[model samples]
Target: MRHIKEYDGLRGLMALWVLVGHWAATIYIQFPWPANLGNAYAVDVFVILSGFAIATLVERKRETYGIYITRRVLRIFPVYWFYLAISIALAWVSVDMWTNAAGGEATSNRLQISIAALDNFWPNVISHVVALHGAVPRNMVPNGEYAFLGQAWSISLEWQFYLIAPLVIALGVRAASSFKAGLVLVLGLFVLSYISPRFPYSFIGRYSAFFAIGIATYFLVNVGIPFLTQRRIVIAPIAMLIVTALILLQLPSVLPVSIWIVATASVLVPSQFGLSAIAGLLRWKPVQALGQMSYSVYLSHMAVLVLAMLVLEKAGITSTYLHAALLLIITLAGTLIISIASYNFIEVPFQRLGRNLATRPQAAE
Candidate 1:
């Protein structure tokens, strides 16, 4: 349960990949890298990280269910509410800009999510908290001018998943000693991961693999199941390779889903060194540092793309290559600077608050 440096490296890499994906979307399309590795494809890494971290923390609390739930809520909600407030503010500004352009006010067909409804922002906020936006259609209407509003979809999904995760882990912990029960849960999650994509607006679609992968990975790593732990190193690289191939090949239509699930499953391999072969490669310090800042990179990458666009627009540079390079520079630089601030100012404080509150003493014995 101690932090894995190699996983941190993967975090950094995945964040970078996601940044590139978004850059490709919001800025220039002339980049040399594959575009198929969009936010949906790469952000699962975040989900997996969440699953891993969450399970590690909560599994230890098998004796204290209330404490477990309280700890989780404390860990998750503070940072989330802060982020949601920021998102709402950003949304307000975006909506403001679009509605009152120089050409005068432009009205939106969907004003349910408007500032007028700001008093009742709880519904939209709760939907985001519950990851039900995609599940329930037209709940949060897109602001025509602000582009990153779509990306909030991931935040909503993460929040929703976090809510159920404790119960899921509670079940998993109960079923842990029973290999058959754990195995059944794994199978059910796997099935959901595969079939949810077809659910037509289900929040479970596509991203459910992340939860499955994380939960399955825990059992694979810790449960002493001979079949799973034996070939972990081999599994890691092979799965990593498969994920890479899928990304490079731009395999749409659930190919990414397939590779990700396989890759996630590979995380279960015992210590047979399946992925350990690449450990040397993934263990470099810089890579781990990158992973630590992955969240900052992700949150700020879109802003980087926007800045890159503005620069290019002002300079009248039309080529994709130039734009991509600028984006890379801006993203890396912005990621570093902003992540430092975000980690210190945003992420770390709430993390301490969560930990302190969870560990605090009760009022009167």
Candidate 2:
């Protein structure tokens, strides 16, 4: 129920890591290791953490479903809409720039931007505005690009989870008294994931297992899993090794799901054991602040990356390494500045409004 600053630190780290991963991928700078592993793994971590946070907080507050859902929508949408507007504007700029460059009968790679922009613009805008882009069967944006906000696919998954979290919490409470019942719930999640389609990106199919892990974690912490808590030192390394091996193996099947489950457990269970060093690192003030604005950072970073790339290209910065490095620097700095402003102005205000509405007497009715 109490705020977990450590989780904030973890969120901060994950956000920055995602930014790095995106920067690398966009620039075609290959890491010796698989480029997608860290960022993809981070998304799982986020899903797990989301489940855990929602379950833990809702249970502690005894919040009504109405209040919970309202707060969630308020928390997510204001900043997201702001970013969406920005993305649209940037998309327009990109299109105009590409068109102007093409008018001189010069060939430029920037024309790809205009091509993608022309693909399903209205459909993409509508789907994204309604948060159904990721849930639909077809690509919401042209050429499978999520318009300009490609990273928002995960945001759609998260918003879907927010809609169902109250139900998840209620079911978790019912299952709390029986370990067997808890296992059944987890198994059900696995089954759902197995049956869901790989295309169109069903949230249940893609992320339910990770979400189950978080829910399971909350129960484990509450019920006090002695083996996990008492053997933190030994289990921590083993958990890390297992996750590392899974990432490196890059198995072509469902085995990576196991990696995420273990990965979430690795970070969470050890912290429960009062691993002071880990806690201290995660609770560091600056890290916690970053975590506070992490949502903003995540939403805005890709846009910053796109703008930075365009600027670099126009400036004729052709060296790949230099381009990548400068882009990273600019993206990180820009993301931080934008996140701070959005968090203070847009996110905090909507969050306050949601709290006020939730606490109003009629809200309980």
Q: Could you give candidate 1's per-residue lDDT for residues 287-362 as a string of tens digits?
A: 8777776666666655444444455556766566765577577766765786677777877776677666656654
Candidate 2 lDDT by residue in tens digits, 1-365: 24666778888878887888776666645567655436766776777788788778676767788888888889898899899888888887766654543121111333563456457677777877867667665433433335557678788888878887777667677786978667876877777666566445535557776776677667666665555557554455655675567669885423435534443443565454455566677778998899999999999997887787678778988777787689788998999998999999999999999889777866667
> What lDDT does the true structure give each of the candidates?
0.57, 0.71
For model 2, the stretches where C-alpha displacement exceeds 4 angstroms are 94-117, 139-145, 175-191, 226-275, 362-365
The candidate 2 region of ten consecutive residues with least summed lDDT is 101-110
Q: How well does each candidate superpose onto the true structure, as a TM-score?
A: 0.67, 0.79
Ten consecutive residues with minimal summed lDDT in candidate 1? 101-110
Top TM-score: which candidate number?
Answer: 2
lDDT of 2 at 76: 90
